[model samples]
Target: MILDSDTTKVISILGNDYTIKAPEGQEQALMDAVTMLKSALSETKRSYPTLIGDRLLVLAALNLCSKQVELQRQHAEELSRYEEQVSATVEVIEKTIAQG
Candidate 1:
C-alpha cells in the first residue's frame, strides 16, 4: 500500500504479524519504534509475570507513555537553556557593536 509516498513493511511483535506503513526514508525509524515497543512489552511481562492480553498491553503502554513524557520534559528544558544562552550571546554581541 502506498499513500503520500509511503511504503509498507511487515513486522512481528510478540509473535503477531503487523503491517506498518511509513513515509519514504522513514522506514528505519518506524521499525525502531516497533523494536522499542516490543522491548517495552518484554520488560513489562518480565516485571509482572502472570499478566497477559490487555492487562499486559496496558501496562506497556503506560510505561512507554511515561518515558515519552519524561523525554519531552527534558527536551523542553534543554531547548529553553539553549535559547537563553543564545539570547545572552546576542546581547553581548549587540553591546560590543554599540560600543565599537
Candidate 2:
C-alpha cells in the first residue's frame, strides 16, 4: 500500500505493508520518521549482506537508538549553555538596575 494521504502513510517493511496514522498536526514528522527508518534499514542491509531477519531489524533499531542518545546529550549540553547565558545576562541587568 502506498501513502494514502498526509495523515495516513503505508510503508513496506520486511516484505510487509505497515500502515501508520499520524495524530493531528504531526503528519510531516511521522512521514519523515518513516523515511528515516527506511533509510536506516536499507543501509543496515547493505552493510551486512549476510545478516537478515530479526538481527537486521535489531541492528537498525540499535543504530537509531544510539543516534537518539547522542542527539539528546547534545541538546542537554546546548540547553545548559543557553541557561548559563541567560543567568549571566540577568545578573548584569540586576546589577545595572541596582546601581541606577
Candidate 3:
C-alpha cells in the first residue's frame, strides 16, 4: 500500500498540477476518477467563476455524493427484486419436492 516516488504522477487539474501517489494497481482508475471530477469542477467554474477553489471542490463533492446516493437506491431496489424472485423459486422447489 506504499505508493512512493516512482509510483506518483503529476496530473494537471483546473490549472494546477497535483502530484498524486496511488497504489500500483489503482493508478489508472484513480487518475480517471480525478479527471472526471476535474471536468465536473471545470463546468462549475464556468458557471461560477468567482467561487474559490475550496468552494468549487465542495460543490463537486456534493454532486458526486448525490449521484452515489441515487446509485445506491437503484441498487437496493434491484437487489430486493432479485431476492423476491429467489424466494419464490425456492418456495416452488420445496412444494414440488414435497409432492414428489
lDDT leader: 1
Give one digit per residue, the lDDT tens place, for model 1 in 1-100.
Answer: 7447888999986677889888899999998988898899999999999998778879999999999999999999999999999999999999999999
Per-residue lDDT for 6-100 in model 2, tens only? 47677787887889888768988887888888788899999998888789889999999999999999999999999999999999999999999
Which candidate number would show the highest TM-score if scored against the true structure? 1
User: Scored by CA lDDT, what does every candidate get?
Assistant: 0.91, 0.88, 0.85
- Ten residues in sequence with the least summed lDDT for candidate 3: 2-11
1-100: candidate 3 lDDT, tens digit per residue: 9636447888876578889887878888988898789888987788789987788889877888888999999999999999999999999999999999
The runs of at least 3 residues in candidate 2 whose Cα sits more than 4 Å from the true structure, single-residue gaps closed, are 1-7
All-Cα superposition RMSD per candidate: 2.5, 4.6, 3.1
Error of 1 at 41 (Å): 0.6
Ranking by lDDT: 1, 2, 3
Of models 1 and 3, which has the larger TM-score? 1
Please give me the total number of clashing residue pairs in predicted model 3: 0
Off by over 4 Å in 1: 1-5
Q: Give the TM-score of each candidate.
A: 0.84, 0.84, 0.81
